[model samples]
Target chain A: MSETTEKTYKRSHEPVFWGLFGAGGMLTAFLTPVMILITGILIPLGIINSQNFSYEKIHGFATTWYGAVIVLVLVALPLWHTLHRIFHALHDIGINRGRDWQQVICYGFAFAASIFVFTLLLQMF
Target chain B: MTKRKPYKRELPTDWWLKHAFYTKYMIREGSSVLITLYSLILAWGVLRLSQGEAAFNGWLEALQSPFSIFIHLLALALALYHTITWFSLAPKAVDLWLKGKRLEDKVIVAGHYGAFAVVTVFCLLIITL
Candidate 1:
């Protein structure tokens, strides 16, 4: 193994860790509230006019500045966190043999996801 | 039963809060209580929807009450923390391989957060419009 092995001590690992944190927090700040509000609207709409409760028919008062920016933040962060956790786990459990190989896969998926999100976000704008 | 001896032992102030291991565990396991509470709220929402408008409005008004608002805020914090820890750990569960190459955990976590963010923004935009 070209890599060193020691599981017990904690390396700062902050680059990936904070990356995940920033992504997750920003995403959560944007995303969850709108979903919850939808549930709020749905509950009343369903009870009153069950047949007319489809989201497509309703105007989106749900759209807001807070939600959009928050989501952008989340989009960037969680992926980093996800990648970081995977790297350590591969090492700890002895699954993947080489560090370089692991790095390749992690970055590969990260790139693909980034491309997909960037495209999707542009459409939204 | 053994004897209890008293020595003036000073404990670390940071204690569980300072430790990553404990912090992760807290965010993981400690979140269930808040989840359960939120679920009950949702369930009530559903039940009221079935019951009709007046009942639903009553529930909504109650949610706006000071006490309910306080509890909701607390639950939101716990749920958010739990979500963070859970997504952070998602990459490891995959043993994720692409084209015979393994993916890094950070990338995976970032991807998941991105999806979450995008959806949140989209939904918000739809609502505000």
Candidate 2:
């Protein structure tokens, strides 16, 4: 084969984002509802003892390595899934202008938020 | 380069609103917005947690607000909707086969629900107990 006949494939970044999206989707599907219920309703309403969510308790948990990882995943991963969907949903709603900018903002927001949480977790540790 | 203008069909902004199926699909997609908001709230909580006990407690206290409760209620409902939709679509993505036979869709979906239940309960137990 001649050198000019060689084909170069441009690798797409879709799989990385898609992998995060799928993992986030799975986490959200399995855990988000109860999380909302506990933090949002049950504990806040005092149906579940507010003491159970006391600051010391949560802070203690967050200081541990495993706890930090869990907290980071719980807080940040869903943004990957949701923001990906939001990006596509914008197109579905016919906001076709600035597709490049839209993709940047969508993925950028998820990236920024993930970093924000990750930084905080590191500091806590 | 030869100039080329490909004809493109115009899609109306309200295209999804015209049909019940499309509306539900859009709603499913829209769940992302609220879930994103929820995640941000948790992120804020983490930030507060790092600040100290007063800050973290304040964050938790804020959750008790009527408006916060309402938003969480809405988010919970939407998140549950997302879960249902995600589970239903799982079989298409999973493609599991056993003993030279493809697994049934309902079986895959049911397995998701079972796992969801276990996870939810496990979280609750961990937090409360």
lDDT of 1 by residue, B1-129 (tens): 869977897655445477798666645554444434544464444344434557656676566566665666666666566567668767766787899989988898998778877876776555445
Give every candidate's TM-score on chain A. 0.48, 0.90
The fraction of reference interface contacts (C-alpha pairs within 8 A across chains A and B) present in each candidate is 0.07, 0.94
lDDT of 2 by residue, A1-125 (tens): 56867688999888998999999999999999999999999998999998998988888989899999989999999999999999989888888999899999999999999999999999987
Q: What TM-score does the first chain of candidate 1 have?
A: 0.48
Alpha-carbon shift of residue B97 in model 1 (angstroms): 2.2
Docking class of 1: incorrect
Name the best candidate (by TM-score). 2
What DockQ does candidate 2 score?
A: 0.84
Residue A42 CA error for candidate 1 (Å)? 15
Looking at model 1, residue A43 earns an lDDT score of 33
lDDT of each: 0.52, 0.93
Model 2 chain B poorest 10 in a row by lDDT: B10-19
